[model samples]
Target: MRENEPHRTGPVLIVIGGLPATGKSTVGRAVARRLGGSCLGIGTTRQSLYAFAEHGGDTDTLRHAVTHGLGYSVAYALVEDLLSQGQCVFAECVNSRKATRDAWAALARRTEARFHEVELLCPDPTEHDYWRTAGRALAEP
Candidate 1:
């Protein structure tokens, strides 16, 4: 088996962070698949939160904060669960803030698991803008 194979033993938290349309989700999923673990996306968590809140009754700011808070909690819980099961986990999020990145590092320390931070970026501004616009258009209702 490969060095990063799930059966190799030891828990790992693979954190994938990037801007919109930077392919964090795709890379995270690919990494998780290669490692035989699971992938979690903050966007998916946010969508679930919106569904749970019935898409109403809150200001956008409040909704965003709540969703982000819950998403972080859920990510921590997932990492803990996978660690307990001797499995690896891949998490994808924007994670633009230092505090957020530190929190993942702390989680790794608390869980005594290996942590890998992968930051995806698009070097070409024009191509990045094009991809971001296309992604936004595809994601819109």
Candidate 2:
């Protein structure tokens, strides 16, 4: 039989939050890769909103609201689903506000999974601005 297979258990939930150009997605993906887990990007959720707006669903403002509202719900659902199935998940998002962070924490509580918050910071102002602008340019496609 396999070695130590019976002791394996559920996966951990890692929630990453940061500002624009803060490398939340980059580092979250790295952590998830190392841990053999999955990474979910909030931007992917927003892109779906943009697509809906492009298809004449709503205005930009409405799209933003709907994306923000639905994105968290979707993210939470992903984490819950992964946990239920004995898998781990890593979520990357700006999570600029305390309320958003708190909501994730609450989800962790309900799922009985450990939650970790990691913030990315750039010590050099110039470097931070450079990365921010460069990231924006690359994101523009």
Candidate 3:
């Protein structure tokens, strides 16, 4: 912070979530780009975590952690730090459960950051399935 800069209240944390083929990643990245902030994606983070574990971390345990709540826990800590520095953040996740969604909201409140929730939905099953299959085609490998 500059010596003469105005005091910041809090940064913004935009939560983008939805089903598997709801375009969470696409929308999260675009919004983060447009807003000039950072994006923390669960899928991306999961891959990174698993790759990091390449040193000695067990694949099964890592997978379980990522699937359960480890990803969100890590994101929460990261967002807390970023928000403390007045950096806006965009978090994209499947967020298939109420508990996950509430955790994001709670993080915003705890950090005193503005909470913006954007839930993407593909109402058309055909389009949704197409995206899902197309996404699978572009595997992480």
Candidate 1 vs candidate 2: the lDDT winner is 1
lDDT of 3 at 136: 86
Each prediction's TM-score against the native? Answer: 0.84, 0.84, 0.85
What stretches of model 2 exceed 4 Å from their correct place? 1-8, 60-62
lDDT (C-alpha) at residue 126 in model 2: 89
The true-versus-predicted C-alpha distance at residue 76 of model 2, in Å, is 1.7
User: For residues 30-131, what per-residue lDDT tens digits would candidate 2 score against the true structure?
Assistant: 877766788988888767766777776457776777656777777778778887666667888888888888988887777777778877878788888999
TM value for model 3 = 0.85
lDDT of 3 by residue, 1-141 (tens): 666444435699998888887888888888677666889888877777777767685878887887778878888899889988888899998877889888988988988899988889999999999989889888746
Cα deviation in Å at residue 121, candidate 3?
0.5
How accurate locally is residue 13 in candidate 1, as Cα lDDT from 0 to 100? 86
lDDT leader: 3
User: Which candidate, 2 or 3, would have the higher TM-score against the true structure?
Assistant: 3
The number of clashing residue pairs in model 3 is 0
TM-score for candidate 2, please give it: 0.84
Error of 2 at 133 (Å): 0.8
